[model samples]
Target: EVKAIHYHPENTICDCCQCQMTEIGTTIVREEAEFIPARMEKVQHIEHAYECKNCKADLSQKAQIKRGKSPQPPIQRSIAGPSVLAKVIYDKFVQYLPLYRQVKEWERYGLNTNDKNLSNWVIRASHDWLLPIYERMKNIMLEKSILHVDETYGQIINRSDGKSGQSNAYNWVYRSVPCQGPTIVLFQSSLSRARSVLEGFIEDYSGTIVCDGYSAYDKIEGITFANCWAHVRRYWLKADSKNGRIGVKYCDELFRLEREFKHLSPSKRRKKRQKHSKPLVDEFLAWVENSPFYGKNALAKAAEYTLNRANGLKAFLDDGRIEIDNNPAENAIRPNVIGRKNWLFSVSEAGAKANAICLSIAETAKANGVDFYQYLVKLLRDLPNLDIHRNPEIINNYLPWSKTIQAECVK
Candidate 1:
């Protein structure tokens, strides 16, 4: 066997000694160089200047001279244009990017901003530009034949009365119609009372309202209520998870009926209810009435839920207009819930209010088939220039469902 030598990879290695090169072992040399090129001195030349036409004076002769047209005052550079700003505010506030994150993004683009200033811009844009459209949407929601209502908790820091640093409020969402797509959501800050918020919204309106079993919904006069079967079925399913036979049976029957309902078209559903569903509903009612488990513990609770709200659950079958569930309203409010996860909470009540306004505009624009960004940009720019009396009709032009506006939108 022959012995082979190996060399390690380094900047310098002595081939004979196999020693690593150090800084002490070497010296760096700086070389100086000079290049001589032919050089020549240039002669100065001057041109004759003309006189100013307006002043009839020599212009260039003077060391300092003013031009005829002075530069216009510099228009301040905003981080974004009106349209871009509206989009940024909409995405950050309504779609829920906390301002600090937005500021960091802008910083990456070489623009500096703080959360407070961004918040102020959002408040101003929403209050001044977006609120009118939101109000219009609410008015449209009120006029619909049926409305779906639901409430969710919202937290606001520094709430009224100064009791605590944080307090719970309500975001009450109302959906006017489905498929045709007219929906509205309203946020109201309250200390856990639904009556004040619900009443305040629908005071002038009297129509059929679909909701889950909430006591606050009970007080509205002249408004018919339809309970969500989904809610009742959900409890039965919960009980079924715990291996309750009665719950399983009830849930199976409910799921079968719901499946049947799903198979029918909206118009066919209305007609079929009188012929087919009426009989199924009658059988279900009799089953509930005759069951030995009607007054038992967990099964009894599910039974009572169905029995007590039997009329409301059946109300949807009678009217084709009423939905099988309060899902439309729930769907409308879902974006807010998604946004809240990113935003965490509002800094103030005003911030929350601004958020509501932006959400209303964005959602309504979507419902109406309008491009939200374009619509918001147009509104922000034109709203300030609008004359309240003369421009009353102008606002109508922006309405999502208005025939004239819809025609323009289609075109």
Candidate 2:
């Protein structure tokens, strides 16, 4: 319970009747919804200096002054304590509460904090502590042989630090396939949805990528691409066909077989697909080449989409480890897209990068069964003291999927 209170009526004169009223047993005990103000406090750190008397007595030498050491502030020169800073970071990143909205909440509770100060705290924390963990997650995620890639638009402020004039930017997401060891999701913020962005992010990634019909994913060399069946269905489902029966039926059939194959081992699933799915695909392609829906209408568009992406759409038949769709990447980034509607925009590239780092860590932790709140609290409180630049190997222990984090953070 947050708190409790008792009420008692007094014996006093009635307001309008001007008569003495006697206290008696309660007729109705009322308990309604209420709230208690958040507990906020102010703290100060003072460093005391001491000088050696022997050193001071030597006039030819400079006085030796030693200052007592204190732990570094959560953000250098910021008054926000670790817990307070951690709460705000969690609120903005995980809960999707915008900084201005948080400012309003704090003002209602009578605190003097503002958005600028809170944003600075978040910026410092992201750059100083979280990016190393994010990079480590990137390295770990790339090791998977099969991954999913997807992109969603994120709004950034106009002329963001003069980095770009574009109002909308890309939040590219990549994640490992299900039933794979230690699931992870990684997000990268970019000024443009260029092919180079994916290339640079992938570096030398030589694995299967399950994605949609985007031309950008096609440019990345030396990687097998498995396209999403959902994209194919969306086109056919949206197309207003005069007789809504034939062209899109194959997509439905494939999905039905997938549902049955889900519980089977990958090798068994692959053999099943080869035996059952391949013939249906052959018939579908033959129909597409000879069908009457060959005009440039919606039906034609649907067929053309499949025919154009035939290789990618059918690549899943070759490997059981590859999921038939890019749904995992889409599902992981869906919350970030929803939160974008509330927070609306990032003011600078620094803030956009910060947003990506926080969302990546939070979602990845949650995907692997770790509670994001506790994980982030531990990160904010402890990560500041590590000397990562000097000893890069120290970051391996801090990764979300590492043995230490798995033991401590997994729910």
Candidate 3:
């Protein structure tokens, strides 16, 4: 049972006459949310000490002694606890609170921590603690037959040169399609937008990737490309005022047909798409081929854009698993876009890569119905005690889809 201790003021003496003032019985006059200032304390953990004084005095007898193992620090050798690290990760990443802003907040809460320490904890935790989960998510995503991929630009401060903001990078997102098993979004940070990023991402995996018609994706062989119709519609939308009505009408008819196949089984969906949607796509491509417009004309260029990507655009027609567009990948990458505004840029390419790893964990956890704070708390608390190298299966237990993780983190 819990009990409350009520505090009351003592009887006051009159300043002038030294007479006791009237006293009111101790009772709470008001109940309100109390603003208790944050407090910090250094806790000394004492290991049990065992000693036999009689044996110690006896030279012939050996002394019996024992000292317990010390508690592990969340970030090795740092004075931060698991909950402290969780709050730091949550505020900086999930809440998008910048490090400088957090410094002031922590100061108010009696921490007085600088940005460097915070950055150090994040980088170390991300690399040593979170990366295994990232790799696991990456493997699971690559296991799928259909994946959606997209790219977004981000800045990395203090590049190879000393000065900052001299270089740019891309956050490449690879994720499973909606029709797949457990959803996972993996972020990769690359200094260049070269096809090598995609090449290394899907090295041996030969699967259909739905994406926008970027030439980088075209260079990768042994993979089927399904282009985004949303991208195509955006082109038409841009040119709508300038003779894009016909193209817009064609896109509308195509989407209308697509909605009808939403709930159909894979094989059945493919059949329905072939019967009803295939002709519309073929007719749309024909219209583009029949019409001629110069690059200067917006409407003509939109038509030509569709014409050039027609092969990728119609890829979904061959299979039900492939989506008409790569919007899911775009949607998955959007959180990075939102986070880019806050915290602005990463300090280095290495830091940018670390950011990707952490983001992959956060986004993948959300996709798998895992609570963000709970996941970080568990990761920070348990990883210290776990010998991941000795037992490779331990990390698997922490995966978002695992029963342990789900039971602990899913809300």
Identify the leading candidate in terms of lDDT.
3
Total clashing residue pairs per candidate?
Answer: 0, 0, 0
In terms of lDDT, model 1 sits at 0.68
lDDT of each: 0.68, 0.82, 0.84
Q: What residue runs in model 1 are displaced by over 4 Å at the alpha carbon? A: 1-81, 93-95, 179-191, 241-268, 294-297, 402-411
TM-score against truth, every candidate: 0.73, 0.84, 0.87
lDDT of 1 at 177: 68
- Residues forming the 10-long window of minimal summed lDDT in candidate 2: 158-167
Please write out the lDDT profile of model 2 over residues 1-411, one tens digit for every residue. 535565765657888898988777655456577866687676677789999999999999999999987777657777777777777878887788999889988776567888988888888888888898899878877888888999988867765446554456889999887667778888898887888889999999988999988889895777988999889888888786743356567788998999999999889999999999889888887877677667888888888887888888888898888888788989988978888988888887788898899898888888877877777777776777777789889888877777877888787
Output the TM-score of candidate 2. Answer: 0.84
Give candidate 2's total backbone clashes: 0
Q: What is the lDDT of residue 277 in candidate 3?
A: 89
lDDT of 3 by residue, 169-232 (tens): 7899998966788888899988778998889988888888899978887846678888999889
Q: Which lDDT value does model 1 have at 353?
A: 84
As for candidate 1, its clashing pairs are none
Which regions of candidate 2 fall more than 4 Å away from where they truly are? Answer: 1-36, 45-68, 158-166, 242-244
Candidate 2, residue 199: the lDDT equals 92
lDDT digits (tens) for residues 69-146 of candidate 1? 322211123334465567566677456787777877666555577878778778777776677777767777787778
